[model samples]
Structure formats: structure tokens, C-alpha cells
Target: MTTKRILLYAALAAGAFISVFPYLLVVLTAFKTKAQLNSTEPWLPGVPPTLDNLGRLLGGDFPQYILNTVIMTVLLTLGQLVFTTFAAYAFARLRFRGRDVLFWLYMATMMVPSAVTMIPLFLIMRELDLVNTWYGLLAPYILGTPYGIFLMRQFFKGLPAGLEEAARIDGAGPLTVLVRILLPLCRPALGTLTIITVISSWNSFLWPLIITSGDATKVVTVAIAALKVGIGVDYNLMMAGGLIALAPMVAVFVFFQKYIVRSVVLTGLK
Candidate 1:
């Protein structure tokens, strides 16, 4: 091989190792005992791998945290897909008075940092008496995001108008065209949106932290933070919790990463 090509391959290999090393350390540390974790070489494999940390995690409120996270992620993702799909279809295919202006106005919200809206949203949830409920935890996200709407709209716009026109000629209404025609063809975009929404909701900490109290509504991210108690950091336990929290996201990326790449390519989303 050419020297340039060899250098490129070496650079890629170095980048991959650098990206994966921290996660590898976390996984390895999860198996270590407390003593091993406190040692200078905590990144080394445990002398004898132990399930004690995993057992304690599972036996504690962690399972509930997992369940809560799953429920919130699934519901929020589904809600976003449904809401954004309809909004995108409208924005893409349907002509309305001031449609472009309105869509642009809505999309402009994306420029606002989420942190800026958190306080107002919290107050709104509080006004509705949803402060400590799962609904409150999910309210901000269950509604579609500007980015999701934009992504779906771009994908929808790329689709041939003839598909919807043909469906309409067969007496299919707008809803029918969306459900039976557009949605089926937009699987890659849908999958991409689903993965994004799931990951975002799963990793959400600040919103859940502000809206929830105690263990009742705590998601895994918040629950994992709870692992740090007044006592010194239990590195092994913390690593174990981190692994548990990370496993689903890793599984999801492994499964849907192809769809994400395909969607980005097809939709021309950078």
C-alpha cells in the first residue's frame, strides 16, 4: 500500500482506540471489587470478576429506574413520531396560507437552547399539578421537537409528489396518503428519528432532575446520579450502574446505526 494510505489507516485505528478506551475501562471496572477499583490500576481487569455489584444494582431500585426510562423513552419517541410525521406531511405537501412563514417560525425555536425554556416549562407543569408525575417528566419531550419536524419534513419533501397524487386519485384522503403511502416509504427517516428521540429521552437528566423528587419518578440517569452518596464514591457500583444505563443505548445504536446513516444520506441531512 502507498505510504499515505498506510498513514490514513493508522490514524483511523488510533481514533477508534481513543474513542473506545474509556468505555472499555468502564466495563472492566464494573467487574472489579471495591478494593480493585480504589487501586492505582483500576482499569485493569478484576482479579476475579464479581457479580456482586450487578447483583446489588438489580436488587435495588435500579430495575424500576430502567423501567421508567424505557417507558418514558418509548412513549416520548412514539409521540414525537406521530406528531412530527403529521406536522411534516402538512409542511411538506399541504399548502396553506402563510405555511412557509409559520414553519420557519416554528423551526426557529431550534435555535433556542433547551436550558432557556426549562424554567418556564417547569412552571407550566407545576401549574397543571403534574410536578411529580411521569407526565410532567415527559411533557416537554412528548411534543415533537423542531429538529424532528425539520428532519421529517426534509425527507417528506424529497419524496415524489406523484406518490401522494396517485394515492389521492384512488380516493385516498390526506390521512390515508400519509399513513398508507408516505410513512411506509419513510422507514429510514422514522427509524432515525426513533433512535434520536430514544437516546435523547434516555439520557435526559436535568429536566427529570428538576421535575422529579425522590425515587418515584426518577429515570436511570437520575438514579445513577443517586449512586454517589455521602460516603465516598463507590467506583465499582458506579461503573456497574453506568454499564447498565449504557447497555440499551449501545444496543440501540448497533441496531439502528445503519438506518441513521441511510436516512442522513437519503434526506441530505448533514
Candidate 2:
């Protein structure tokens, strides 16, 4: 048993090293000068790495890109949380006409490839004169996604019925019960949903690239891609921007990691 434990630890360590090495390399490369970056020994930066590239990115539109990404992600996440929670509540508690069929149909959308719908979405945006605008960029995400609904439904289903029942008995309407009792108890699920929604919106590339053509509406992912060309592919500036873009996601994950894990565990428990 001791030997088996030793092997398992060794394997896990090896896996961790493999996963972390690329990011370390990227970070190291980001500190190197162009001459050093292009050199055969570019894999490692020397004793005193410079922050020149970071400075350059900070001086450019990278700051604006970061701001835009934050705004867009926050807006989209807020909309998703409200919409998904309500939809999930309805599906889990309410008895209505075609509820099951409608839910099934919504879930069916998860199976469809996003690429298949891009053209139609683009055309609709154009028709609405929302193209090249922040509203246009965020409009698609404002509608709660199928995956969000599905996740919330699962979490909502796992909730005990007693609390809601007690609230109803206390002269609480459905909305009152949801707002006062259900939602407060749903902190773990809400945290999980926020983490997922924020990450997806932050990392989104293709849709933002296709829809927003100007800086006014461009998101971090698209901005990052443009940086490659804008700075003549200056590796350090690009890396700095990449790191900046990733900071919010990392902070969010760190903050809510416990609840996110709990939510996942509970989903499986049900």
C-alpha cells in the first residue's frame, strides 16, 4: 500500500509539472527581449528579466480592451444569472403546459454546434442595426444559454422542498418565496453559474471576432489577436496582455472555488 501511494504521488506530481511547464515557459518568454526571445536559448530568461514589453502593452489599447472585456462579461453574467435561475425555478417547481417538452427542446439546443448558427445570428444582428456596438456584441449572451438553464435546473431539483413550502405557508407568494428563501439557499449554485458564465464570456473569441469590428465593441479575445499584428507580434507585449486578460478569471476562480466545487459535487449527488 505504501509503494502504491508513492507511485500515485509521483504520477500526480509528474502530471502537475507537465501542465504547469507550458505556462511557465510562456511567462519566462514574456520577460525576454526580442533578441533573447528569438535566440535558441529563449526558453529561459536570464537573471534580471525586463518589464519593457509589459510597459508597452500597458501604454496601448490593451487597457481599453481589458475594460471592454470586464464590462461585457459582467453584463452578460448578470443577465444569465437572472434568466437561468428563473428558468430553472420554473422547470423544477412549477407545473405548466408542455414544461417537459419545452425543457427537452431547450436542452436539444445544447447538441447543436455553435458554428452552425453563426451566420443566422450575424444576419439578425445586422438587421437590428446592432453591429459594431456593445449592445450588439452582448445581445446574444443576454438570452440565458441552454447549458446555463440545464445546470440551474439540476441544482434547483436537488433543493429540499421543505423550505419553499414553509415560506408558502407563511403567506409568501411564489416570487416572495423564491426571492427570500430559494435564492438565498442557492448561493452555491449561483456561484457555480457565475464562475461558468464569466469564464465563457471572458474566453469567448469567435463570436466577438465576427460581430465587433471596432475598438468600441471589441472584447479581450479579439483584442489579443489583434495585438499579435498591432505590435508586430512582439511576444512580450502579447504575453503581458494575455496575462492581464486572464487575471479576472483567475481571481474569480480563486474567490469562489469552494462553492464551485460544492455545486459540482451536489449536482452529481442528485
Candidate 3:
């Protein structure tokens, strides 16, 4: 058992190092000079690190991209929380005709790849005159996603019924009970959903690229992509921008890592 535990620890450590290697390389490259970045010498770590690349990134349109990403992340997270929680609650506890059938249909949509829906969704947005607007980016997410609803529904199912019963005994309306009792108890699930939505929305590339043209609605990922030129790419500047884009995600993970882990555990418990 001791030997097996040691082996497991070794394997886990190796996996973690492998995962972090690329990020470490990016951080190193972010601080390298343009010559160092493109030189035949290894890009792993520059002999003398410099912040000139980082300064260039800070001086550009990177700040606007960060703002756009934050706005999109916050909007998408809040929208998903509200809509998914309500839909999940209804699906979990409410008894209406065709509820199961409707939920099944919703779940089926999950099997459909986003690539398949991209062109049609874009056309619809264009027709509605939502192109090149924040609304264009946020509108699709406002309707609640199937995976979010599924997660919330599972969490709601695990909740005890007596809380709602007690709330009713106190003359609390259904909405009041949901808001005051159910939502509070579902914090872990909500945290998980928030993390997932924020990260996904923040890192989104293809769809946002397809819908929003130019700086009108350019997100951080798109902005980073645009930094590359036709023939020669500025590796240092691009890495600096990439590092800046990664800071928020790292901050979120550092602050909410505990809650995120608990949420994942609760998910498996269900």
C-alpha cells in the first residue's frame, strides 16, 4: 500500500508538471525580447529577462480587450445563473404537462455540436440586427444552456423537500421559497456553473470571431489572434497579451479553487 501510494503521488506530480510546462513557457516568453523570442537559442528562459514586450502589450488595445472579456464573462455568468436556476427548479419540482419531454428535447440539443449551429445562429443574429453589438455576443447565452440546466436540476433534486414545506407553512410564496431557501442551498452548484460559464465565455474564440468584426466587438482572444501579421508574428508581444489574458482566470482559480473543488465533488456525489 505504501509503495502504491508513492507511485500514485509520483504519477500525479508528473501529470501536474506536464500540464504546467506550457504555461511556464508562455510566462517566460512573455518577458523575452523580440530577438530572444525568434532566435535559434532556446525560448525556455532568456539569459536576461526583459519587460519591454509586456510594456508593448500594456500600451496597445489589450486593455480594451480585457474590458470586453470581463463584461462578457460577467454578463454570461449572471444570465446563466438566473435562467438555468429557474429552468432547473421548474424541471426538478414542478409538475406540468410534457415537462419530461421538453427537458429531454433540451438535453438532446446538447448532443448537437456548436459548429453545426454556428452559421444558422449567426444568420439569425444578423437578421435581428444584433451583429457587431455586445447583445450579439450575449443574446445566445441568455436563454440558458442545456448543460447548466442539467447541473442545476441535479443539484435541486438532491435538496431536501422539507425546507420548501416549512417555507410554505410560514406563508412564503413559491418564488420566495425558491429565492430565499433553494438558491442559497445550491451555492456549490451555482459556483460551479459560474466558473464554467465565465471561463468558457472568456476564452471563446471562433463564434465571437465569426460574429463580431473589427474593434467594434473584438474580444481578448480575437484581439490576440489579430496581433499576428501576414508573414511574421511578434512572438513576444503575442505572449505578453496571452499572459495578460490569462491573469483573470488565474485569479479566479486562486480565490475560488476551494469552492470549485467542492462543487465538483458535489456533482459526483449526485
The TM-scores of all predictions, comma-separated, are: 0.94, 0.92, 0.94
Supply the global lDDT for candidate 1: 0.88
Evaluate model 2: give its TM-score.
0.92
Instruction: Kindly list the per-residue Cα lDDT of model 3 for residues 92-204, writing each as its tens digit.
Output: 98889999999999999999999999999999999999888888888988779999999999989889999988999999987998899999898889988888898899999
lDDT for model 3 = 0.88
In model 1, which runs have C-alpha deviations exceeding 4 angstroms? 264-270
Q: Write the per-residue lDDT of candidate 2 for residues 105-215, one digit (tens) a residue.
A: 989988999989888999999999988998778888777998888888887788899988888888999899878888888887788778878888999999999999998
Cα lDDT tens digits for candidate 1, 142-169: 8799999999998898899999999999
Instruction: State the lDDT at 252 in candidate 1.
Output: 76
Against the true structure, whose lDDT is highest? Answer: 1
Error of 3 at 30 (Å): 0.8
Q: How many backbone clashes does candidate 3 have?
A: 0
* Candidate 3 pairs with clashing backbones: none
Candidate 2 least-lDDT 10 residues: 39-48
User: Model-by-model lDDT, in order?
Assistant: 0.88, 0.83, 0.88
- Residue 165 shift from truth in candidate 1, angstroms: 2.0
